[model samples]
Target: MTWLILISASLNALLGLTLLLLWRIERRHAYVRMWGWSWILLSVGLTLGVALAEPGLVGLRYDLQALVASFSLMGSLSLQVAGARDYRGLPRGRGRGLPVFIAMMVVIVALAGIDQRFAVIAGASFLVVGAWLCAWWMGRGGDGGERFVALCFVAIGLVHASGPILDPFSRSPITHTLGLYVQMVLSLGLLLLSVRRAHAEARRQAERFEQLAHVSLQGLAVIQQHKLIYANPAAMTMFGLRDEAHVGRLDLQATIPPELQEEARERHRRVLADPAARIEWEGTRLTTDQRRLYVRSLSSHLPWDDAPAELLVMIDDSSRQKAVDALRRQALHDELTDLPNRNFAVERLRELTGHGAAPFALISADLDRFQLVNETLGHEVGDALLRAIARRLCRQLPPQAMLTRLGEDQFLVLIEETRDRAGAQAVAEQMMALLETPFAVGGTELYVHLSAGIALFPQDAADGPGLLRAADSAMHRAKGRAGAAYIFFDSAMNGATRTRLEIEQALGRAIAAREFLLEYQPKFAAGSRKLVGFEALVRWERPGLGRVPPVDFIPAAERTGQIKALGELILELAARQLRGWLQRFGRLLPVAVNVSPLQFEDAGFSARLLAGLQAQGLPHEAMEIEITETAAIGHLGRVLPQLAHLKSAGVHCALDDFGTGQSSLTMLRQLPIATVKLDRSMIDPLPEAQAAAVVSATCALGRSLGLQIVAEGVETETQARAAEALGCTQLQGYLLGRPLSAEAAGELLAGALSAV
Candidate 1:
């Protein structure tokens, strides 16, 4: 037992010394770590007095053990005080009265040494109060280990304080020995507990280190003074490192390109000192003879250490980003010409307009008759021709210019920063010159032409799409001229296009507005000066626009897709006119109105037309539909069946503007037409070389096919004589009479018939 006493005393002294060193040398607190050490020493002093001596100093030992137990209780209180200082929620150093009580018990024990029940009673009371204070400290929830130790101390104090009071009643050495042994065990337990707590804390530190090594979106690494300490999985993969073995072999400088080393090092140094600093390593790629890595490294000094300390270097590969940029480029631009596609071009124009960068100008150009080349030669030749034209235009265009290939034959140019109209005009002239040269494909020469249009920003048009429309309108203006040419966008073009758009929109309300009116031109027989038929022509007498000629609004309606409604209205009006004429005159003379090719191609044209005629109670034979050569040739499949259905319904068909386009003697023989109207261009000259030959040939072709020929555009006597001499069966134009209003035309028709 004395040996046990010595062992306990020695261990206690060692623990106390250890705590003092950690508190003083390491500058750590004494409450949690050092306070536990104080309890170990106090427990040892109690055990030695009980276990040593011949009779084991029974009376002396009990009193001494009481004193040591009182001190041990104070250790837990000290722990609570230190914990409160650290956490701020627990009680501070406010247990001043407990120290006075400890002093009082020490004084009482000294005065009545052994065999003094009163002093023992006083010491035990002090120990109980001290233990209660320690328990209160633990109830505040300090560190887990310190709180557990405090709880054990409270229990030890309560049980052992009862021992001295009960020792006098039943003086058993074994009972006393049992109490000493319990002290021995608890001291040893606290020491073992302290060791285990230290081990656990070390393990937690390791786990945190591992977490930092792996926790980041970017690849993280630890590079000591530009040398690799560790490479995270992300960093290894980013730098193309196969494994840790690869990482162990290289440094940061070795992985980065030579040109980027100086900048990378400077950035790394800056980030290490200031945690907020972010450094971008510009070019971090490996060469053929070296390993390449793209890394944007951020370095920071850890809390525990400093020099060669640790760096949080991040590595990122930019090659995937480069590939993404390339893919984006390919998506928005044409592959062959490397020009912007329609979508990208429109988007760029919109962005420019949003910014209001400059006075932008848009030029739209379409290769005139480019489809003829594709149809006649081949698609490959056509493609070559387009590429050749594109290359030529690209070379001639200004360096700052942006060009877009809108379609097969259309090109759009955005003049972003043009100096003046002169600059735009100069660019247009350059384009024309480049395109004028003949393109040689398959060892054969082919010529190409372009009709160009210009639209200015904020003046002629407000935005990008509006500017494109303005340019398109200008191009149509150029197309109407004799030769293919370019024209600058003018306010006049805007006025005209706006007027046309208004008419097209108003066409829907024409029947409701009563603005739509029909006129008739008389058709006469060649030999007999007798009335044969009347040609009904549509004209719009708009309120403000005055008389909108059919030549102007009719073509605009067709282009704007409003002609379907317009054509239907014309037919309804003609049917109404025919009904009136037949009801009043008691004669069913046929009336012909020109139907556009687009109107004839409508699938429901027949049903709608027949329904209108039936509604007006007009005979089908008294109504005639005149179709142009272009309509008959373009949609021949849809037009022929529609014409046959009309003829089957007892209606007559006339081919208008014959011998002008693809019209010839062969097509005339196959068409369902009963009459052919010679084109104005074909009837302009006669009895004079070329004009006479054309008229004679057309007349002969018509006669051979058993079709009646109507000579059109005869304005003077000379033209009438030529048409008459050509054996034309019918003639129409100003020579006979101009197109008159419905009332006037009715009078004219009545007068002619009365004379006949």
Candidate 2:
């Protein structure tokens, strides 16, 4: 029995030391520590039991030895139960079990002094109960190792129970040896349980990592020693790899573009040097199929299979980059014409005018009568026409020149290396000439005209915006000319534009303040010098500026669309003068009012004019409308109906400035006019052979058509007499009488009537 106890103690000590080493390795599992201490205490109890049975061993009293060994055994049993509870995650009894167990042990020890049998039974009972509790706790939710440990505990408990039954006073050699073997098996099972748990936890973590790598959207690759080792699904797809087999064979150098491979290698070296270093860059990558991919990549040092490796995370940024590029293009380009817009033009201008840039010409071209096309045709056709014009202009541009659509009906051309104003003017002329050929749009042959303005860099203005403004001003000046024209920017045009802007701003206030008046020029019958009628001319007398000439403000008013209001004011003034004359002399001469072509464009012009005459209670025959030949020819379709309407209502219509325009005899025959006024240019050179022949032909044509002929600007008697001989029905000029105010004209009319 003593040898068996010593052998069991040796085995228990060895197992305890092994468990303690494991606990030291993983301190978080405190149950291992507890189990180890329990085994050590059991070993101590067994050794003491041997000493108690052999009295000469330690030279202590039998009862004392027995009591000490019993206490050690009880403490070991308590620890075994506690360790089991902890391993199974069961709660401690909050220290109540400790005091009760201590009291029970004390009682058993006192009784053992009187009867050794009672101590034996009580100690054995304690061992059996504690072992059973451990078995229940460990086997409840335990794995194979823990269950095997619990079975060993049960076997050891039964052996201890048999020792008390068979030999109540002395230790039993057979049962003690059997309990020692079972305890050894239980210790081995505990160690195996710890190892199994660790292995299972490691497997679970690896599985989770694998799942994440497969599902990740970013391409993840591990490279070691310049060779691809591992790649996730995303990485395989990104590089056009077939599977893991393909990735294993792929070289890291092959994935990077040849030009960037050296840089990539340097970056990899840096990343490996510092484990915490993360390098990011944007570059092109080559796929398995030799396709290029734009990628934003991040490279970092990582550990793979216990070796240094590089982790490359590539995000496919190709789509995002393409979207960004497309958005940039849309921002700078016109969608309708697919041409660079004003924004791009401004950017190009800035680039061209930078510090070391060569001189360039900025040509601003505008389509003439574009609004007329938009109004007459549908906007669809207008858009097509603008696109066609843009194509033609683009074709005509020189290779060094860039064309950009500034806005509706306006294109800006930038010609590089332009030397002088003449070079710029040449480009402008070429661009304008392209529009002279008709464009076929929507099955309609459309005749488009262009007005171009050229401004030289560092000559007209220094910078981009200033150059554009100078060119635009020149373009407007060119637009004022008859047909397609190109002009160079001069400093004088800026002053003229400013003055025109000021005049346009003041026109509205001028009309509202009644700062205008009309003067009448008398027209006399050439045969008898009898008063025929008077032509009403509007004059402005600004308060502070005195009189502003009609030539200065009239075109400004028309351009600014203030002509309609000014025309209404003139009509009202004429009606009032006629009313006054009727009240004073009981009669009035027919007053001819010059109407603007813009006014004739209004569909309601005749309605508004006839309504005004009727509101004054004046007869329609008391007024006549005079339109210039240019107005009639330009807006022939629009003017014809309005003129016919007025003529049918007994209001006479006359074509003014006839010989100065390109109106043909056919156009004259088509007009609903009662008279044609020969312009001052035609009348000034009269009585010369060529001029006489021209005048004679005009008069003969007029007589054949049975239309009245009036010669204007008849400054000399010979010219007036020649006009009369050439069949002039009426004459009006400074030669007869200058323009007069309403009162003077009224007095003149009264005298003429009194004489008759």
Candidate 3:
């Protein structure tokens, strides 16, 4: 028994020395270091007790006995702790472990005076520590190695607990032997734990690698010696291949397109030669169904997998890149014509400017009859015409010329270099000639014409923005030409344009400030030439600006969308005048106010007109609205509904300037027209045998349509009599009475009522 005890103790001392050497090599776990010290102490104390084990021997050191007792218990406690910690990677509990162990050693030395009392104390401490270790490992349902270690700790704990009772049955040598056997068993458990721990670590690492390979967004793969050592699930999906055995063995070049194989090879070479290099490419790959896929591939150096290798990460940019390209097209091109838009034009101009391509000519063009086209036909036809014109202009333009749509009905042409003004003029002339031939648009043979203005670089102005401005100013000048013609930029045109812009600003201010007034032009019964009603013509009287004619400001107002407010002001002023005339003459003659297309299109127009009538204490019946054929034809859908609403409210509507527009009597039947005002052109060809026939025919048509006919621009009595004979009862012209101020109109109404 003594020989066995001695042999086991020596073996434990060797195991402890091996642990200490392993800890010094790699101090990964602090618990291993603590257990090593414990084993060494236990081995040394047991060795000293054996050497001094002669019973009743003289000079038997009491301190040596106490040390032996304490070291034995402490060694078992350390084994229990090491197993607990190894099961779960726990931190070193209480950083004061070393100091606390030193203090315990000092106390044990002081207790050496007691007989076996220190052994009892040491046993109790081991019981508590071993019990905790048993609980920890017993709860772990995993790891067979850990369960085996837990049972070892439990047996040692039981032995320590029963030490006091078992001591009565045995002496110190017997108990020491039992403790040696337990330590030897604990050492074997540590050996099994170490072997199992290495196996578990390898298994866990393999599982994590498999998860990464199966569930990753990027197509990850490691290539070694021109062969794929690993291919993740994403890699198979990206290459559009099934997870076949051959796929993992295929080289990178085999997966790429034949045309891109060289690129892939070069990329791999670059990554291998320079580990820091990050290479990327826009590549095409075949999908499972052989559908081509566009993607961007990236490659970088990967850690050596037994050889030089590269890591490839592929990102599919197919759908997202397509959407980005679509957005870019929408940004730089006109959606309707597919031509370059304003921004693209500006960018091209900048590019040209940067290249020192001076002495170039910029021509600005505007469609002359586009408004009439939009008004007579529809916006659909208008858009078709614009696209047709864009195509036609492109066909006639030279290769050096770049054409762009600056905005609606306006285009820009940039000529690289102009030898002289005639070179630019010749191109503009050719474009104008092409428009002379009518375009068949929407079943209508419509004539399309363009007016262009030419501005030379370094002559008209400098820079892209300045050249465009100058060209636009010249374009307006060309519009004032005899026909659709081209003109060069002149300073005077800018002045006129400036004055026009000033008038537009003034019109807006006048409407906002309520600074407009109305003049009355009376309409009479042609049969008796008696006063019937007054035409309300708007007059803008800016304080120092005097009177701005309706012809000048009305068009400006309509262009700027200030017509809605202008229409409201005219209604208000006309209502006021009508009310005053009724008070003085005791007659409520209807007042006719012209309505613009823009004003009629306003959704709030009817409500506002009715509100004005109510505020002025006037009936809707006393107000008549005169709309040009353009207004009715342009927005027929909106204008017809608005007319229906106003007619329901007892307001009168008449089609004014009828003959000037192309709308036939068929439109008159659809419209809610109380009267048809024959345009001044109708009277121009009147009072003659031929004119009388046409005039009488027009009146007959009006009568058949259930509409009253009023002849406009009647000057002579002969014309008035002819109109009356032709069945037109109402007549309006300067011959009857020129436009008069509101107060003068009141006197005129007063005299007429008195005469009646």
Candidate 4:
């Protein structure tokens, strides 16, 4: 059927043009456009002979027949080039060599008019080469679809090539008919190849998405009908499973904690029923080993296994998230009392004020004489007392009130949801009663009183810090009164506070300006009144204020950290004086310098002190560190190590204000002190039977503990005699020699050179 050949050519040209228009619209594949052009060439070749019966074309009919064959041959070659360009990403222009091939084909077609058989053989060779190239190019792509495309090219090309080859040898109708069938096969093959490539591309995209899901940190899994269809490594690890099989084996509902499983099941049912529904649930997961782990899971719809599926994402929120919360708490809470610290209190206050909260009260409570507990009993006992106080305060506070430690012996109570000032007073009184009870600290029953200051919202200075300051000023006013009590903030309290702050500021400047000088109080042998070492007393001389009493600044300095720096200055000054004394007297006697507990806690205290002494050519044994009993007990543990270090370094240490502290015999025996400075209170009542008994017992204890007993604050002859009879070895007070300036002290030392 030559008509069939013509029809096939017409159909090929139509298909080519349709595909060309489709490619322009879709731009799906690079090979489609070239394949369309090839089909157009084949249609042109078939059409060449379809109208050959015209008289005008009768002389050129053989030439036209060869031209049709050449066109058909080149069309097949275009298909081969199209395959290469599509599969290998090669350019169609480079691969086809279209214009050169067309020129050569036209020349060959012209020569074919001389010998028709030669043209048939040449065209068949062209078909073979083109078909093989197409097969090879398509083979370079992915498997399955690519293999079929290659096979189609080979089969169609070989079939069409055989027609031209056999036609040259035989002039049979069967041989001519074979080309029509081959053309049909070619058209069908091209459509099949395109279809296969589309399927391959879809499969590749699915693979790429799967790979991306596999590497994700979130536990990703696909579930169809509550059975796992796929699981990534994270998903498997989250479920304590080995593979997809394990994921399917474990029932999700059963894996959740029993109490939470009901909600989880309901959520799952709702999500599965709707398919588009999304749900997030945070719950505990039960491991195979019966351990529970916290996890937050999110489930949403996804197309998996060719159906609507569930994409499950599990995030482990147990250890990591809880650790973050704990760190946040540590930042807010006090390490010792586990109470909210100053920062947390301020933040809470800001929150309350930001919301314009009303009628709340902030009470600043400072424990009165708390330092004595620390200094007498040691820091261990002091910390225990504070923690006990915190617990007690927290227990006693009203429901809406929050208690926070503002460091040291100070605490803040915020009545967040109070009604009026009466409600504030009720909270303050409740806290006061809590402190009224005796607390067992370091094996001793102790009573701590609170001096509380109250500042109300809107009534007092606005804002957190300002309100807290007003409360603090009121607290100071309360302290100035007879007993432990609470006072409301008033306008005049601010003036007192400002004055105190100014004094504190001035003290800071005085130390920096080296405006302090030391006065040495001579110590004597109790019985002989023989000269011994002198105690170094720090005296501050303000420019306009003259000499501010030690009573005014010493306590303030002790509360602030000015004591540490001031102690360093005093120690350095003392070391320099010792060097000068050593040169003057041909000997260096110990000059006792008072050390605050805060100063003793310095990590570099021992090293720095020794270095300063060494730099001044002063002997470490020529100076003694006098620490109050109250200060000593507060930092007992820290002091022990440093004290031992000082003893090893040939430095002297003594307990000052001896009997005032809670520690009596234990510290005397335990600490590496060379002397115990008996508090003036013990000797002030001297010569009385009771006072004598106390002094005798204290001195006996000191002697038994291998400690030197030096009675301080000896202001009378009777006190000195009592101290001597009470077994005191050294005496210090105004009775023997008042605290003297360096020049006066030098003169006294020179006068007492014979006695010394």
Give Cα distance to truth, residue 554, candidate 4, Å.
13
Per-prediction TM-score to the true structure, in the order listed: 0.63, 0.69, 0.53, 0.55
Cα shift from native, residue 411, model 3 (Å):
2.7
Candidate 3 structure, TM-score to reference: 0.53
Candidate 2 yields a Cα-based lDDT of 0.86
Per-residue C-alpha lDDT of model 3 across residues 1-756, encoded as one tens digit per residue: 456556656877887777677567546555556667666765665455433344333344645564665666455455546546654766545465556555666665565445445645554654556565655654478467667666666766655555455553123454556666776677667655654565566688889978877898878778775777777888787766577585665655545689888767777788888868888777687665566777877788877755568887777777887898799889989988888999998887777666456688899999987888889899999999989988998988898788899888999999887767988998899889988998888998888778899988877776788788889999988888767988899777777777789988787767788888888899998778788988998887889868777778888988899888888778888888877766666777899999887887778788888888888788898899999987798789889988988999999999999878785768888998788999888886678788788778878888988777899999888788888988997999988889998888888788888887
Ranking by TM-score: 2, 1, 4, 3
lDDT string, candidate 2, 1-756, tens digits: 677778888899889889899889878677888889889888887787653365333234766777678777887887788878878878867577689679768978777766767777887788888898888888877777778888988887897789877776537787777877788888988888876766776788899988998999999888888888899999899989987888778866877877998998888888878889898899888888888788998899998888788998889888898898799999999989989999999988888888867888998989899998889888899999988877877887788788899998999999898878777777777776777789888788998888888899988888899999999999999999988998889999999888888899999999999899999999999978788899999999989788989998899899899998999899999999998898899888899999998998789999999999999989999999999998899998899999999999999999999888895878678998999999988889888889888888888888888888999999999999999999889999999989999989998999988887
- Candidate 1's clash total is 2
Regions more than 4 Å wrong, model 3: 1-76, 85-111, 115-192, 215-218, 222-230, 243-317, 343-362, 374-380, 394-402, 414-447, 455-467, 488-496, 507-756
lDDT of 3 at 119: 40
Candidate 2: residue 454 lDDT (0-100): 89
The C-alpha stretches of model 4 lying farther than 4 A from their native spots are 10-45, 48-76, 84-125, 135-176, 186-217, 221-233, 236-317, 503-756
- Residue 11 of model 3, lDDT score: 78
- Deviation in angstroms for 754 in model 1? 3.7
Q: Tens digits of per-residue lDDT for model 1 on 442-531?
A: 568988888999887777777778888889998888777665699988888888988777777777677467678888888777766466
Best by lDDT: 2
Lowest lDDT 10-residue stretch of candidate 3: 50-59
For model 1, name the residue pairs that clash: 284-293, 286-292
- For 593-690, candidate 4 gives per-residue lDDT tens digits of 88888887788898888888889887779889888888778898888888888989999899999888795577777888888988989889888999
The better-scoring model by lDDT among 1 and 2 is 2
Model 3 clash pairs? none
Q: Where is model 4 poorest over a 10-residue stretch in terms of lDDT?
A: 49-58
